[model samples]
Target: MSHGSSPSHLRGLAEVAAASVLWGTGGLAVQLIREHEAMSPVTISAWRMAIAAVVLLVALLAVRRAGELVELARSRPRQLLVVGAGTAAYQGFYFVSVTQVGVAVSTVVSLGLAPVLLTVAEAVRDRRPPAAGRLVVLVAALAGLLMVSVAGHASSTGPAPVAGVLLAIASGTTYALTTAAGGSISKESSPLVLTSGMTLVGAVVLLPCTALVDGPHVTTDAAALAWLAYLGVLTMALAYVLLYSGLRVVAPSTAVTASLVEPVTAAVVAAVVLGESLGPVAVVGILLVLGAVAGLGRPAAAAGPVLPDPDPVRPPTAP
Candidate 1:
């Protein structure tokens, strides 16, 4: 079915788009948090997940879907682990990548690689080649992402670019796994349940690491607390709700591709808020990324859903 003809798909697209835009703010938020709070990326990530988990649990209680979380934990413990572990890995890896290569490059590699990895995974699972048109869209989107990454200036504080790229690639793979698993889990339960489970799991996994590695570095300043709250509430909790809501109708690969808007948003924010300058190439790159997302938003006749199985067998779930 064409996204244009389906109201659900349209809603899904908007939901995903909104989530991506909000997520774009995360890099800046982290930067601000860093300015006020002296903490490791892992510690910040731990706080983000822990706070988001608590918020999600409260939201579930309010909506009376708290049982879904318990049911998922009882029934699909492994998938829950997968989603949660993937989330923790993505955040930790991506944030470290940011420190190593800077936000634009790390964001590019982390967000950019998910769609390609997911698309390839879908093609391999389906035992069929991706449609030529869809492949074109993916290529355009990736090319655009690369343009933005290469054109944007990296922060001077980072380490080797190669290491950062590797870390970002790992972040992308973890994110792809999370997105794929999320789509699968949402099929059997509500988005709220899936998000709650994942957030809790991620919190559980990261909280210890934060305490062990960054025990002496935790910050409790008011400004730091406020930034963490914003990251947890808007970027993590609310963003995942929109993400999973969109996954109900959109393919996981497409959803990640749609989220490429993140780098664009980050670039603009850097320019306007941070007083960073974007050259002509960066402007062109931004347009390409925007174009790629637009192409994905339109109706496509041959595309199919890309959702991983909740089970470890990795079957493609039906949309």
Candidate 2:
């Protein structure tokens, strides 16, 4: 089979898409958790990372891979730190931006910008402009993202739009850089190990911030705890494992673009599960985003350097 049509490549695309869908569920989980507890976003995020790290570490130990995680930390400390800190920084900036500007602006500016940044970075790294087709996909996905995000929260403007936009930019930049760095690292490390270590690092980074922002309150409410567990295990832990595994075969730019599915999935979930109505424009935006991701799945567009699997005998597993 041709490179683009290889099982691994197609599997990678599916893995990334699946991860985005899982991420989409996080919004609902967060909303549910908030309904049951008065926790701030930062505190929730800290809990999410902490829970995911513990779960991942426990899995590693169960699989007799604890030593591998330690080796990863020992050998690639800087890269691991960068990935972990970047993950925490982007989410922190995004949450703060939401409070400062509003969800519509923060979501569009932060989530929408990462794909564009990664595409441009890829072009620069390759010393050639992005293919015309890739550019079209990027534009379509971004337009869809803007429409979906803005339509949902048209009147939800925050107190400081300027600061929010700046924070969103910081979030986007960090997200793009982190994706790039993670993709590179995945070429040499197990996705599970990498995710475990980075999540631990991210939890450590976010704990103090959560303490300062919301006093790090953990809800004893059963429903809230369940939702928090969903956010940590499904969204953070499994989703990231899939993301890193997908990064092994998919280009960083394409992977980020594929993740645009998250907002679309979120919109759909909100509409169906919460009985929130979606306007015609939002429906169209969902179509556009889905179309763009489908376009990216084309062999020509999806083609990328397929790195050697870290463990040929045991392929990266995704939940």
Q: List where candidate 1 sits over 4 angstroms from the true fold.
A: 1-4, 101-105, 154-162, 212-217, 301-319
True lDDT of residue 89, candidate 1: 88
lDDT tens digits, residue span 1-319, model 1:
3345366666777788889998888878888988887677788888899999999999999989787678778878888899899989888898778778887788777887898888888889989888877887887777878777777764444777899989999999989988888876766777777888889999999988876664345677898889999999999899998898888777888899888888788888889999989988888888887777777656562134623233322322323
What's the CA error at residue 257 for candidate 1, in Å? 0.8
lDDT of 2: 0.86
Highest-scoring model, TM-score: 2
Candidate 1, residue 135: lDDT: 80
Writing each residue's lDDT as its tens digit, candidate 2 over 1-319 gives: 2325666766888899999999988989998988889899899999999999999999999999898777777777888999999999999999999999998899899888888888777677779887667778888999999899988888999899999999999998999899999997887778898999999999999988876775338778999999999999999999999999999888887888899899899999999999999999899899999998887776555423344445543433322
RMSD of each: 4.3, 3.3
